[model samples]
Target chain A: MINIEDYAERQMRRRGMEITYARMLPVVVRRIADNNGQVLVNSMEFDAYNQYWYLVNAYELPVGTRITSDTHVTLLETHTNDTMEEFSGKIKIELPASFTGNVCQALFYQVLVK
Target chain B: MTGSTRVIHHPIQLIVRQPLTPVNIYTVLPGHIRRVVGVKVVHSVGVHLMSADTYLPAIGYLSLEFNNRSYHMGHVDVSFDNRAEASDAYLDTEIDIIPGSLLSGHYENKVFTGTDYQRADGTITDKWSNYIVTIYLKALSDD
Candidate 1:
């Protein structure tokens, strides 16, 4: 696993930015399933400025099944002459209180900055 | 120990060579100590000008390539509603990794950007920047 905190610091140093602060937020995972039982991966909208990561984990996954793997990514910059900012947070997959079942538990992982 | 057993610690090391410009290129070399390879990138850039004649806006393309081949994955794309608010112009993108084949090799990256300036007579001057960040992902050959 890549340490998000360490990578940010190193990258900033390489680009001549001073390390001012670093914080790690818990991970949030969410999943949705239709009445037919097909699993749907939840797409998340992470707001770095708000310092929050939110997801709706609705499906309870079996222990041994390949429910999901690593979180994939894509990044787009709307402007040209701007610099990329750095921040860190932990990622955890969890289920909501309104749902319950052994087969429907959300897979949670601890996210760390370094 | 085999290559897959090696562990990669946090705060990975990054070596950036020479000055980067719109034409010059650089390489990000990966060590053979990591088993899983992934990338998450985000940026917000906008245009600015001191006067109507001195306008500056930037545009670019980013991709992940391994051994000269680019792995395609599910991605997310976003764009802002307005163009004048340069600071609020936001876009987010994320791409997944490929299966089984180990991420091991020197990856090549090519990037460029263009800007244009025109006066009342419609005379225009176009300039471009070759800016890119290349990454390498590999497992420990011998652990």
Candidate 2:
């Protein structure tokens, strides 16, 4: 029950940023592993909570990883600009009664970093 | 052999099945880093690409929900080891993967990007692929 663009917009706002892109992204759902080691669907309507989602994998990594379109990610906001601080926002996501999981991940895109 | 015999042409049908979907667990304690738990997924379908041209296959992405935000996970990994060689087919190869894990809620979304990967170049090229297949988790003590 979530449109991708709206999801992106709200996600951007929640992250204290605005959408400054030439196009809108289609809402696509992807699964990710949470800290609890559980996979969850990235729902647009549910993308405001910092408690259950993340933008990237690898709990920790050293520098020098290939940043491809495939590896790019958007956690709370739909799109991220050049500034890294724009990713900051305050929104705690609440899963639906039907969404029974300790954690989960959603999928989105961004430019890969070198 | 001459064309005196009748030749029959039979069509090959293709059957596709649904990919396995993974389950996840999201949680956080009062004084612990947030983490995902109970993740389950399966291996993605393989794709073969050929030609020198750069190509990108539009495949479904993975995301994890933490702190009320939807984060992007990378595309599933395609096992190239099984294939002996690359073909001349130049196209994007999309794959569907499902993996499972058990988390105990002591993580950071930003930390996920902090993985120890080789930054030889800006792109994750074939020379040093850091694609992960298995994940190990530490059980959090009950507070």
Candidate 3:
């Protein structure tokens, strides 16, 4: 019976890869309010890398006004940028009416996987 | 890090005036800058309301455009607010640009006007002529 560490090392060696951790990338998404005091929904596409991306953490911006109660982050498996069958995802964040007429930034982290 | 490529930070300031009117500012990247890696809003004035009742900046929108593409489809104030102490508030991304490429910045003041601004001490005045916003671009140069 092979030990867990040895099995992991063997798998890494077989895959021609190094023992590393997930790569976390920071992304900022903005939700703008329209003239009618409605918060517009915003989305960002992650097509920069050919790896599976997962949301790690998210927080609303503007320092003191960290109101993220109404903010929703959705991860979609569909490819919005291209039809290529690569590992890509879309992140969409919706803000509530309270965020109307204000430009809010949400800082989020995405982890990349191979 | 290569010997041929050097890092540089280019700063640009925009003077915002006239409510509901967009203020457009542009800068040509120097010959050394090959790509813009990051952007940060360093400082800003005349954006926040002086009235004690209001604590947030005036309702405004800011956007960056380069190479015929906009970095953020909408406003970027949250990720690039001027209240940042250091370079902590920055958008880390790679934007390819050539020498002499035109990088544009657009801003629009949505709420406040010249006459209706109230100071913190409950004084109304039109002394605020313009809002000054400074942004720094971190780039890589292939010298």
Q: Which one wins by TM-score: 1 or 3?
A: 3
**lDDT tens readout by residue for model 3, A1-114:** 223344444444553445444444566556655779454554333443323333333233321122111111122212222111111223334433233334444432232324
Q: For model 2, how big is the iRMS in angstroms?
A: 9.5
Question: Evaluated on chain B only, what is the TM-score of candidate 2?
Answer: 0.18
- Native-structure RMSD, model 3: 15.3
Using DockQ, rank the candidates from best to worst. 2, 3, 1
Q: Write the per-residue lDDT of candidate 2 for residues B67-140, one digit (tens) a residue.
A: 33334332332222223353322223121111222221111111112112213222333332222222222212
For model 3 the local lDDT of residue B15 reads 71
Task: Please tell me which predicted candidate would have the highest DockQ against the true structure.
Answer: 2
Worst lDDT run of 10 residues, candidate 3 chain B, spans B78-87
Model 3 whole-model lDDT (C-alpha atoms): 0.48
Model 3 ranges off by over 4 Å: A1-114, B48-59, B68-74, B78-87, B114-127
Off by over 4 Å in 2: A1-5, A22-114, B1-19, B24-31, B34-143
Candidate 3 TM-score versus the reference:
0.44
Q: What do the candidate models score in CA lDDT, each in turn?
A: 0.29, 0.28, 0.48
Q: lDDT at A90 for candidate 3?
A: 39
Instruction: Name the best candidate (by lDDT).
Output: 3
lDDT of 3 at B69: 26
| Model 1, backbone clash pairs (residues 3+ apart or across chains), number | 24
